[model samples]
Target: TLVKTKGKLSFQEPKTKGSIRTIKVPDLAIQTLKAHKLKQKEIKLAASSAYKDHDLVVANWTGSMIDPADINADFKIACKFANVPQIRFHDLRHTHATLLLQLGENPKVVSERLGHADVSITLNTYSHVLPTMQEDLAQNFNVAMQNIKKKSL
Candidate 1:
């Protein structure tokens, strides 16, 4: 993709107008990208005689468009080798959304990242986790009630 930056870096376009957003990268991801960029530069220079600029973050060694199917296949094999249980690559998206909800992220924030039609989608998908959060809140509610009762006496 073209480097369509707003200020410092560009990102994949949101699927819809409602979906457009900026996400902060973790420190580890930033450092990893720096190392990867340096290595990519070396690789490109070495293959300069045959390389073509494809402008993708990851591509075939000859700088051509990497087949999506081949990448998926490779990913599957790597997942299996790493002893990860079977899960679709798409599942990672769902996993991320669920993790965010478990961490008590605002539903609106999680919804935007997943490019959901709305926050309701994020809530519905994670209602099971929400119930546990409600249980924790109930304890706080009880404490508040006790405090109010003591004040009245």
Candidate 2:
């Protein structure tokens, strides 16, 4: 995580141990990141001595950290160009969690992916999705029982 203290920027540990985790990325995302890395490499070659080389996945053309405000501004422009509704970048995290829960993904897995301190936090945060999951479970149970009855017959 990045911390801004008294007019200085620095990297810091996550707030909780749980927050330090590896996440699975989709193949498409991996490919995109690889392409971005190649582009960054070219930029580094061009910048030579001028490049700061903080080794960030995302950085300025000169390989320095991009300010958060600059990121937000770019995000706003991207949203506009994409014809998407304006939303804070952080909202993407909530959307990802909610979508997974709604799709009936295991709460524990989702919690781990989100680096939540506990599964209960994922359950509580996504309680609104549970009712649909329960309905699906009941339907699946009924189907299983029907199949068993047919096999017995």
The models' CA-based lDDT, in order, is 0.76, 0.89
Residue 42 lDDT, candidate 2, scale 0-100: 97
Candidates in order, TM-scores: namely: 0.71, 0.85
Candidate 2 has a TM-score of: 0.85
Which pairs, if any, clash in model 1?
A: none
Cα lDDT tens digits for candidate 1, 1-153: 223344333446556776566778689989998887777778789998788876756766766665555667887888999999767666777888888887878899888877788889889888888887888679879999999999999
Report the CA-based lDDT of candidate 1 relative to the real structure.
Answer: 0.76
Q: What tens-digit string does per-residue lDDT give for candidate 2 at 51-153?
A: 9999999799888777777788888889999999987777788889989987878899999999988999989988888898899899999999999999999
Q: What is the C-alpha RMSD of each candidate to the true structure, in Å?
A: 6.9, 2.0
Model 2 Cα shift for residue 78 (angstroms): 1.5
Where model 1 places Cα greater than 4 Å from the true spot, the runs are: 1-15, 139-153
